[model samples]
Target: MQIPTKFYKIIAIFSLFFLGILIFLGVVFKIIVEKRKLPRLYIEEKNRALRGSIISAEGYQVAYSNKLYKVAVNTRCIDPQKKELFVRLFSIYSKIPPHEVRQKLRQKRGYVVLSYTIDTKTAYQLKILSRKLNALDIFIPYKVGQRVIKQGLTILESGETRNFPYGDTLTPAIGYVSKYEDSGYTKIKGIKGLEKYYESKISPKQDGVIRGKRDIGNNIILNKEAFIKKRLDGYNLHLNVNMLLQKNIENILDTQKADLEAKEIIAAVMESNSGKILAIASSNRYDPKNIQKRDLPSLNPKFTEYPFEPGSVMKPMTFSLLLEHGLVSPLEVVRGYNGRMKLGRKYITDEHKFDWLSAENVIVHSSNIGIAQLAQRLSYLQFSQGLKMLGFGKPTGVDLPYEKGGKLLPPYKLKSEIYKATVGYGYGMTVTFMQLLSAYNLFNNDGYKVTPRIAAFITLENGKRIFLKKSKKRKILSSKTVATMHNILQKVVEKGTGTVAKIDGLEIGGKTGTAHISRGGRYQNAYITSFFGFANDAKHRYTIGVTVFEPKTKHFASQTAAPIFRNIVIELINEGYLIPKNEQ
Candidate 1:
């Protein structure tokens, strides 16, 4: 207040000069301090590995993952002067209309999507186009709204998508996968069948991460000091399925499905000695790549999931159990009740009647009364325990997902004569198609139960192969008992209920079953016809099973399922997978 005007002007000048210097030092300090912290505050980018593949036994890639791309345009960065050129180039590469491209570019938004799924070839071409535009300075790098437009074209990996080269072939067995949002990240997950069963082994658990410093432009600084965490890719699964054989089976089922007027058909072929599934097919298959809502019903593996009362097919198993316990002999004769008999309120009947029948003939003829009478001789514990040992009432431990172990009444229930008699002829219990097939396999495999498996091995990305552990066969019957049952089953095809399945030179042994489909606690008009059998010469041995649900044309399995079994044998021989002994 006391100073002169010139002194006050000098003091104001000094104050202004010091204030400018302090501001400069503060700016310098912020730049230096933030820059120093840049190494600690890194920009992290993750590179996820592709999902593993599913390889068929014949080395065909049934299911595999393919990398796709997402293409988008940064409208704000694109040069306004070269809009025509940009539209033309982008439209050509993206397979989109030029006018559409112009429309997208004209939008006020900084980012606009052009395509979500483009193949590698198209993505590469578009990336090349992006580089060319950048070389020509066609992108005006600047901030628009919240996005910094460093480039006009953006091509990013949209993650891997599953591809099935064979389309609908082996569906529900090869299974399917889908994309889902998990914690703000997109992930591909298996939805059904083997894909879901082996999800842990088939899906990548960890992704690669690169942590590095960024410059003022927020771009990753390329230096050797960057931290990198390598990605661990999933293991590749190898199935026991033979694609060619699987296709053949599907084709046969398709032809038979139309002729039989079946609601659905399921078939499977397995090696007798080793529990490897050779081919499993269904008539109601859908393409895993393009699944529709209607295909939902056919998405689960029916062979392992579907369970029904397996009618006469259980005769051989029951007979084998009786033989193992010395309760019945092949030549022993019993009353057949002339095709009908009453046991506790319900009547047991045969298609054709006989006053008396030999034990082996009871099986060959599928005499419900005779087998039931013979089964009653054994205690309830013996019968129940015997079937359980044969792998009934339990999952087959198969590699497929959603396997159902059909219901088997407890041994205490079998104490009732009605339950005992009904179960002896394959009622009072339920079994899946796979269980029946595997149980029948015991006879062919020398009474040793071999657990069925669809997958054979797994391979790592490092060229290491991990084979499945070999499971020892569990013996359920003596070799002599198996031989006796084998001869009995052979007679069933030669002249008995399964004669329709007999080929000229190829000897097939099997049992035919026809069970009423139950709905709302009542048996319906629909029937489930099945044929479970095996064919073997010196060179090859295979167990084949076929089930036709609600066949409109026929009721008896001998007419519906037996012929299908015969045709399958013919196909095996035709394909050189089997050799017939002699044909006159």
Candidate 2:
């Protein structure tokens, strides 16, 4: 084991040299691994480029994005000596003053957005100015601006607008969206109508995730770099509104606008069988061209935003309630004359003087006294329950923003004569036109109440049509009550104030409502006009409601609203809403 001194020294030196070589190799390997796994201290500077498009049900692009430039100033790269020159050049090019730019630079630690969505001409000018001024820190990032329809077949040229080629035609129903600057981010928000209701699905989130594709090796690869995520665009909506029917209704409203002297008009046409809204029109509509100055008044009418006493239009609903409870047969006799009766200090009267009338006559004549007597006879609890059954005091579950749930005063609150009388004739309490229409379904359908909906289906970008689900129906009245009320309402168009609403060729039924507008809690002589219509082909079928608020000349529904109903029904007949006599 022992060797010579010279050989031992040689072995020791070789061993030490080998150990030194091993340590150096280990150090080199460690440095390489550390470099490969090094955590970067700098933040990943990302430029957000967002865009959205609006397309019709048929995939016609209504609104789409166009290229724009996003200009930003990288404060970190701005030289102290050239800061003033950079601010001056930006101010001159961007129309922003130098003081503001300087203030922004002082407050900002990194990059500061100067302006977004600049036109190409302005963007180029700024780029040229930055180069001339030697402001290399100015960054002009290209992006897509929200495309607004300037003009199209079913759209109009408006300022960054979501337009219906039909303008103001479906304003109350379809709704509009607009861009807003809030909390340092630009956003497009749905303010009303269907825009607000289905915003989530229609307007996709920016942080949406995307799944990556697999490789051929059959082993999962950890290649985060290969996959890319982009912002998902919102889905397109196809409404239940029949274009032909909607156009016809709009024309009808236009034709009657002058005579009615109305401030606003709204009409809704629905299929009584399925509760699908066929057409909805709101008058005083603005051009979707100027979305920034959206005329909220005309866009949202009495249907959704405004609630008022519905007058005798609610008679069928009340009658349905009574008949449903078996409290009164349609033929049950009630005494009323001189058009007035006093109950519990509340005086009730019909518009015209009347005598003993059947329950059917009460609805036919819209006898306020007769209805009030009936209300007196029924327990308050029963009346409230019946109102609830008819979908009163509740939202129709309509997919619209700010849908009003009209107020229904509790029975205990009806201490005054005015309140009771008004309630009997659709006063004191307020209900939206949509709520009234939904409640009116009790007479047309088999006692079932279904929520109204605007969206027929949602079309994905890939051309998939997914039908929006409809709400379940609840039995609000007995089948017998519906049948009886149908007969009574039919008589209303045949012989009562609603006779003007009758279509010549088809059997039509409806009610006329002329409710006094309450000013400061007192009923004024001015009235809100209203008409409700039901058409049948040897059986109850379609229901429509039309309302015109605060007509200057004719305040009665029979005069102002009825003609609109007549025109709508005529168009519906022409479109084959009526069965042929031979077919029937």
Candidate 3:
């Protein structure tokens, strides 16, 4: 191995350099691995102390998370005499049976959770018990649970839970939640009303970890060392509904339903110019908070679900269409004698017979013959197209769930004269209340059809507010047609069937409708009561509609529904939402 001194020195230096490079690379790799693992450890540590506060709109804490002690015992650590006394005292204070306490004490496990989330009073009592019994293994560990509704009893005597304060008032609008017996988790269900429709947005997220049960006689220790993910609360909803107006409207409906002894009542107040629903009240509504069982029919309503012949209300649409197409003028006279007209094989009759009635008089009197004759003048295609344009035979695209799109007979498949005549009077078809309201928007908004919405704005937990803008208005009718329809509706209240709804000081314009329910393809004598009105003040605008189904006594729209409209309008006037024209 005899090598030169310079070569040997060079080899030694190269070897040292290679060794140092290896050491430096190893150190760098170790640091990279440690950095990668650091985030997970940090996450676990932070989650162990995770806490959040739930604030209301007024910035008060509705719920929050705080640290507290969970008390437990290892029965094996104490003498039998001391254990028996400790178990007896604990049973009385903690409400666990002494026998179960004795059994838990006999277990070989080192830790057991006797009670979780104990208050200061109970903690003090447990401390006293621990001293008196001389038991050193009365364990108390830090834990967290939600502290909600700060000043209420955890469990009430009536077995009814302490829920949102305005439960009954918001039942139909805000839904309820219930537990699944099989899953053992709270599920947001649309037991009824708006809750069901917006359940996805309102429901709280579920924890993916499954709950496990401990063996009998073993101490149950929740791994305080184990990691748990925190849950995010459901989004808060801000509705266009004015709660004050909603309460008053509910009260009014309750009072009226009692006075009239009506079977069912529904009233909806909407912003005339914007189509924002201010309040919707239905009498005989079930309490969402207390519903142990679901009654499908009574929970929603016939107004939203059941579609019936709208009767004379369809008259306005017909008249509007006629005017829009330049087919008729308000003053044009038509022969409607004896209140009857024969169209093909079907005979259409008005409630009262009159001769030489003008189109204005026809709408004022709600002449069925006049409307039917006017419809006959238009080709079947034109009539159907007009209806479709006005949003009939389609859904109104309202934000609420389970809205029904009214049914209309196919124009291509019309096989009978009776079917056509029946449709002329709002028969042989069906329409939801929302659809009708949307259709009426054409008459109110100068033929600009606006989509209806319930949510006015959404507020985030960080105090950010986002307002929902209305969609662009669709033009469905000419201004001239709208003007003519407005004149006809004005006459409807001035000297017509809707006169009962006339406000004393304000200019009120609307229509009245009474439709008979059909059973087994025959028109039943049972009638539905309805009244729709739009009022404009110098600054404020309002549209109100009321519908009552199967009233006990008189069933006419003018007698039953119109008075309710008048009451609401009177209140609106009194509240200054509608000022008297003379004041302006």
Candidate 4:
């Protein structure tokens, strides 16, 4: 009656062998199970938070984040019989070609990403497509394992992606964030302009974590809402950037850049009394979204970075020095050296033939020869020190990165009289257009020098705002000198070289410069033409600086930059940025 011993032994051996295999698999897969669960566990512990918005003074969103959805398909869930139908219908929902969807559906192994960053409308339609096809299938987004068992289509809630509303319009000054690939992780950092300068204030770390059950897919489940840390939103930056003014300036510059076929144009507008930079625009700027084409070094707020010879623009600073030191008077007469004079080995000449002109007439006529005569009265020490005091050879401490400290020759190095003389008429030195803007503020701000600023305040999520403090003012010139210079500059706009800048009913004053670009220590045929002035109505005055680099058709500041300045001022008046003095 006993069973065969060989058969009994064989059955026992098979059972033991099968049991051993299970044990080995358990040991091996224990680590794999834990490793596979790490992503899900991490999501369960983490929260989701948002980034802050970068806004303009006028309350326009410059850089902000918006929610986007990813539409995907679980190929494994699709029946082979309905593959073509699924692809065709899903393609309609995703706006993708059916052929492409068909290929993914045919794989039938895992999930396929059908689309990314789809709008809510398309997402809703996708959900509808799932419902219509499966009849009982409801596209419940973010379920356990990124799947709705009844539906093959997976609708997922994705993280926010950034949106630049203005694109390149305010990019140069507002700047952008960059992704740094460091040590196998992507780190976001601001790499230029305000974005770079105020990174700490704008970009707070994302401490948000998803603390809920997620399906095998990393999507958070509908079972529990993510408890997120709102601290990551950081603080919103309200810049002194006037979006409309910025748009207008950019439009004008773009048109002029094309017409002139110039290399580039740099322009900015500032609140004269407060040193607030309202709008800065450029012909060349980087699109923040296009990371590949951006040349970081070339893209900048040019108004504060690029330096050029002041040309006649320096004449005002020099004349201010002469008046401040009591070395010159309004009616002080000086020979223009018959429109020419010898300085060291160079013959400094005026733009026109002049016999004699008063100190006031010198500025009124923009007489280089007259300025040279004034420079002769001062030693090199006096001239160099004067420029230093006027914010030359220094950065204006502007709220930007890579601000330039312009070239100012040492007094000891200025042994050559021509160096001193050329400096008097805006040569032998280089200053940024912004430094000029800061220096010229002295005349309008009653001889007080103010630092130019871009950011106005930081608004927190709690509804409290912290306004940025204005830079401390330093009196670089006496009030009497400021008034005298103002009167002289007004005359210049009224009846002199800057006459083109004069608004008919408004009082405006400024200087014109056509500086020769130096290459290899010699003056090139090219010139940096510019006009910077302050135009005032009854209530407000704005300082505007416009420069054209290497113009093809015109070479004079009066012709190129002056007209642009005039148009800008007239537009300001027309737009009621300036109220007429009579109206006031």
lDDT tens digits by residue: candidate 1, 499-528: 988876675799989888888999889999
- Candidate 3 lDDT at 525 equals 82
How well is each residue in 1-584 modelled by candidate 4, as lDDT tens digits? Answer: 88899999999999999999999999899867764533434355433344577889889989875545677776656666666677777787778888877776566556777766676678889877866877633232234674334345667656456678778888687777765443333346677888788878877556555465566645566554645443367678888988888888888888888888888887888888888888888888767877555456557667777888878888899999988888888897888888778765778777767788888989888888788778777777777888899988988899999899989988876556677678888888899989988888888889988889888899887879998878888888999999999888889888888888877668799888888989999998998988877888777878888889999898888888888888788768766788766656
Cα displacement (angstroms), candidate 1, residue 111, comes to 2.0
Off by over 4 Å in 4: 1-48, 67-73, 84-89, 92-97, 116-160, 180-188, 212-231, 291-298, 582-584
TM-score of each: 0.92, 0.71, 0.72, 0.83
lDDT of 2 by residue, 1-584 (tens): 77789998999999999999999999899878764533332222222333344444334443333335567765655666767867777788878778877887788656566656565566668756756654354333232363221110011111122435555555656566677653444456676667677777666444333344444422223366444456456676676677777777887787677667777778998888777788878776665546545475566645777888888887777666667667787888888877877766666667778778887888888888888767655566766766776777888887777878888989775544456455766877889999988877767887788888766787676888788888888876778777777787888999988888865556678888888888998889888888886887775388889998888887878888888888887788788767635555
CA lDDT, every model vs. true structure: 0.86, 0.70, 0.66, 0.78
Q: Can you tell me which runs of candidate 3 are displaced by over 4 Å? A: 1-162, 181-184, 189-192, 205-231, 292-296, 413-417, 582-584
- Top-TM-score candidate index: 1
Q: Which of candidates 1 and 4 reaches a greater lDDT?
A: 1
Candidate 4 C-alpha RMSD relative to the actual structure? 5.3
Give the 10-residue window scoring lowest on summed lDDT in candidate 3.
151-160
Give one digit per residue, the lDDT tens place, for model 3 in 1-584. Answer: 68799998999999999999999999898878764422122221111121122223233332223323456654334444445656777788766788877776566655566655465455666656655444353332332253211110121011112144554664454444443322321123444445555555544443323122333322233465444555444445567666666667778888878877887788887786777887777776655546646534566655567676788888888788778778888888977868777877767877778987998788888888877777766667777888888898877766666667888889853335566556666777888777777777677778888887766654544657666667778888988888878778878898999988776567678888889888898888888878876877767767778887877678888888888888888777766678887766
TM-score of 1: 0.92
lDDT of 3 at 496: 93
Between candidates 1 and 2, the TM-score winner: 1
For all candidates, the clash counts are 0, 5, 1, 10
